[model samples]
Target: MENKQINIGIIGCGRIAQTRHIPEYASNKNANILGYFDFNKQRAEEIAKKYGGKVYESVEAMLADNDIDAVSVCVTNSAHASISIQALNAGKNVLCEKPMATSLEDSEAMVWAAKKNHKLLMIDQNQRFAKTHIRAKELLEKNTIGKALTFKSTFGHGGPETWSVDGGPNTWFFDKNKSKYGAIFDLGVHKIDLVQYLLNSAVNNVSARLTTLDKKDSTGKLIGVDDNAISIYELDNGVIGTVTSSWTYYGEEDNSTIVYGSEGIMKIYDDPTYSIVVIKKNGEKILYDIDQIQTNDNQTKSGVMDEFIDSLIEKRVPKSDAESVINSMRAVFASIESNETGKRVSISGTK
Candidate 1:
């Protein structure tokens, strides 16, 4: 069906759904947002009224509608797998927000459910689609900087308070029960996925330190999860790197990656004028003028929602498919374990 349009239902009417998923999907010619469901009925109704979709009182009600061929699971970190699995079992493709699930087991289950139901399962690891990152990946593939030796990738911001729909210290992001882990999952996962994608390798070992530095709840106590995290990773290809995530960056957001290679170094988003810069050992410098990476404040076409729609229409796996992202999730889990156990944690399998 070359002219087919995929019907979509959004599972949660949170900030991400409203800001990213809804707008992007609405812009895709082959995707239609037909329904919306949220824990708060009024919120769902509000979104439906503004976005031209039916409001379903419950997730089950939304999934039961056969007209919705796909659903975006934009809920809490803990609920991602369960809701996405439910949608998959109901014969709907799923586009789940990043940090796919709270646990590796849950992530695996979501992948399995999609395979069993023969539905597409795309993870919203939008970093892969960043124009700068895409160019960096191509350069790496071409050995533009020679074999990568080491790297550092970081994603930090003031906090999720201003970004979440309910802006406050007590936002669900700081709640361990709802978010499981804080910055490591919220910001770190994106870097982990991006580094792996850029290097075309899997992280096989991780050592981390996670700490709660500044965030406090309404009761004036530290939040239940870590606000800052730093991890050392060793990729299976013998490349070493450091990944850092934090909510304590009180100034401008810092989402940059620098890779040191045998020939020279490649910097992404580290320079104000150039999206990517390469300096060779021979003192030759190459610059690429690409679009800035998407941030919470400056929203852009993430290319995730569009990719999900195209995957459904083309009958192919998405660029950020469920199975492909498991390795990145594995690295995040390893980092957590390393922090808890005070030792280096090795990823269980080779990617």
Candidate 2:
């Protein structure tokens, strides 16, 4: 199996798959894209032309193909669980996009399906593979920052209206029924997951305020979803942090995270001038210049798919497995609950 190429069947041909997942997987020599599966045949065909694979008319067609070894489920948040469950039941390894499912129950089911079917289930929390993030985690283990004390992070952008495939308000990202939440769910999940990964802590409690303060459709009516949210979380390791996520930044994307520690401070993706910079308590500063994390807008190898394929070959769990990342998802949902109830909520049960 090491010498033989792994065939991949993709479940979505939209912006994410075409721009990031498909391209990254295509460039991997150990993998072969068997086909792309999308409800829209024309859209699938368009991607197939550029990515060198057939257009699958339906998901069943892709799953039935004996040549396909794994599937990448990149559909909307609502569809992630069902599609991934089907793929796992069909005996295919799954690489799902982040916020694995819209709810914790669905997330757990995806994990259970993978375990029950004996297939790999990895969530695409790609920030873990980001160069600076990995470096931060390594330094933290080495106690460079001397025990992360508190964190303040923000992830905001103009909006997803201009970020999706067609770039409009009608994208599933803005639909509450489809997406479940707005900025917090769409953009916040990544950062929340990053906090957990970098600091090696679990968010045990949350108090939040999620609102659709400024989002409206063409007719200027409330969208019934949160466009912005501010949350305070208590990690199991006694680290308290604030997370602000919004679709209303109205500027260049802001994906900044600052971790304050006993000895020094570590900032990731925050500085406009540098990728990473650390300032010690005694006024000594050190800057670690590094490349920005890859995204759909930026066409580069995200290193996620490459590592996922390597995990399959090595028969080991991927860096971002479903079971482990569920804690991050729990924190996200807990934030929503706290926002609704105006009280702190506890999220228990995490590995």
Candidate 3:
């Protein structure tokens, strides 16, 4: 907030930091990378070497730096809430990677921390900024899609080991203690957030099946976390649908989402050839050529970090602020419950 420039620090110099956060923040005039911190100091040092930031010896040291104004929490899923909460209580704005946390309670605590410190706590749900998805939401809101009914979404890619920094089968992404769940928590949340965003709905219940059908660790053993998940959700508005996430697509990555309504069926990311497609109830087809959706594999621009900085400077809450984060967190935890109990679990979309 000093001179409209926010000094930024990064907690986890892993793949996402390099692939998304560090580069994206570097391109913005208002956000400055003050330093980096990682359990592996060498990794942090390496990022600072190329990106122009000092390396912190520990999270405590980084948090104690009064010069730093904000921090990006891009560690594994499990560390998101803890780091973000610490940053917020340290009086620094926080832009945390998605899934909010492994559980709803952690996410709630994170929100509480943000409120207690009067600092920004934003979850980086960047798919909402995808041109196709943005256009899809506009159409839905304008009734270009009429009364929404149901939807189905799928997000998949080759396993994370390939992209994780110095990765192997033993990367933190596959560890249950570090990642919580594989494709479910990692990729599934992205698709689910887009679904709720476009539909303007909140999940009321979820039934899910999560599995590790094929992924294995270096010892050729199945990792404790899941590799695939399929969930059926019923939203408060009576819209019902299925969501799928997997680390075994083994083909071109699939991050497609389809929404159904009385007037039309809207499709997004369904075709590598098209950004969006819609078929009206009367059988008329419409197509939109917009920016392609960003994938971890793609370097297309992401507006998440920039948006966070802008919001902080303008004294406004970011688009992916705490309330939206908690709702998405509710949906995620419900799916986890459904998977564990093999029963449809209820989600309370209330405070």
On lDDT, the leading prediction is 1
lDDT of 3 by residue, 5-28 (tens): 899999988888888899999999
Colliding pairs, model 3: none
- Return the TM-score for each candidate structure: 0.98, 0.97, 0.97
Q: lDDT for every model? A: 0.92, 0.86, 0.87
RMSD of 1: 1.0
10 residues in a row with least lDDT, candidate 3: 342-351
Give per-model CA RMSD. 1.0, 1.3, 1.3
**Pairs of residues clashing in candidate 1:** none
Candidate 1 lDDT over 133-234, as tens digits, reads 999999999999999999999999999988988779889999999999999999999999999999999999999999998999999999999999999999
Indicate whether candidate 1 or candidate 2 has the larger lDDT: 1
- lDDT for 277 (candidate 1): 96
- How close to the true structure is residue 181 of candidate 2, measured as C-alpha lDDT? 84
